[model samples]
Target: MNNQTITNTHRDTSLGYKLGVFGVVITLLWIGVFKFTPTEAAAIEPLVVNHPLIGWVYNFISVQMVSNIIGLTEIIIAIGLIVGFFNSKVGYVSGILALLTFITTLSFLATTPNTWKMVDGVLTTNFFLLKDIVFISISLLVIEHNKKYI
Candidate 1:
């Protein structure tokens, strides 16, 4: 293709990608605020405090400010991901936030000690751990896929 045509094609692709990323970020943020429906209490029911380390982590993460900050930062990162589409600096920041989120999630899960007693005897903690893994994977995907556009 001619230079003009090639440049136009690239611009269109980049614009489309940026828009798509922005849309996804908005959807995720909305779901988190509305549909994810985090209760006033934590998602995991408290396990019997049999382990000291687990107990310590659990108590620490339960701080109101800590949880609130985590939630707020999640929203901020969503914004960053949307804006990051237009600039490399924002994209890198978003990636860093995602990594931080992964770390926080790991600590949250680890602190809980054990899953609630399910009637069917299914271990639910594994499900949460898997979800966190998926979150990390998506963060990586965002970083990898949009690095070029950013």
Candidate 2:
């Protein structure tokens, strides 16, 4: 027989977990960086304007200003994720932030239907937005895997 043993630590030691975390970290960092750019701000205008939860932000602050705030928050969360890898309190907060971010992203499906163009009577979403589902699962896994085992 082959030599392979699956245990509770499977998820912790599997390649999927490492790669998933790395990908999530990279994406979050990039999202944080993009929020500072003019193009990114302009690009997100539609999403912010259409969102029912936070769309009112435009009424109080300019899109660029809001974009900057989001960017800063994302940057902080990214740092938290890195620290969480080592078992820190901030890492816990990162898990919360990550979950919230993905929730917001998934909300886009209900808030902004235009983003998902209709093709052959099927509502098809862009890979960029749909990818949040994957991140959501990853964030959950990270939260569980990083928890202290005592």
Candidate 3:
């Protein structure tokens, strides 16, 4: 490819990366804030209660408190990701956290009951969780992109 073409392609790739990070940040921020609401807390109760690893949290705290803690964690992660732009170490840590976040959410697909259903002959599951796969990919990319700086 020509030098100009290569430059354009690189620019586009960089823009796409920025957009992906922005998307993840926005999603996490929005969902994290929503987690503070009673509606979201109740909605997630079933999934959270069914998880093998974290289900015990409900045993010690009220559902709303659990949701609040999760929300706070997410907000912190989002801030970490933002700061990561300037500090590679922070970015790497945030990327790993983001990766873990997505992975944990994806796990709900298997841990949560009745997550799958046959709809019109096609087996479907909680489509919301499926997006985490893409988020996970972005998190990995974020890690790789920051590794050079670290």
Ranking by TM-score: 3, 2, 1
Q: Please provide, for model 3 over 1-150, each residue's C-alpha lDDT reduced to its tens digit, 9 standing for 90 to 100.
A: 356654553454477888898899999999999999999999999989999999999999999999999998889888888876666678889999999999999999999999999999999998999999999999998899777656
- The window of 10 residues in a row where model 2 has the poorest summed lDDT is 1-10
* Global CA lDDT computed for model 2: 0.78
Best of the candidates, TM-score: 3
lDDT of 1 at 60: 59
Q: Could you tell me the lDDT of residue 31 within candidate 2?
A: 91
Candidate 2, 1-150: lDDT as tens digits:
112322343434678777887888899899989999999999888877889988899999998999998888878888888876654355656877898988897887778747767799986775687888998998887777656431
Error of 1 at 147 (Å): 4.1
All candidates' TM-scores? 0.57, 0.83, 0.90
lDDT of each: 0.56, 0.78, 0.88
What does the lDDT come to for candidate 3?
Answer: 0.88
Candidate 1, poorest ten consecutive residues by summed lDDT: 40-49
Q: Candidate 1 lDDT, tens digit per residue, 1-150?
A: 256654553465466556555654775476345422345224422421333343455455653333354456667888888765555567667867776666555665555544444557764555544555656665675676556554
Error of 2 at 62 (Å): 0.9
In terms of lDDT, which candidate is stronger, 1 or 2? 2
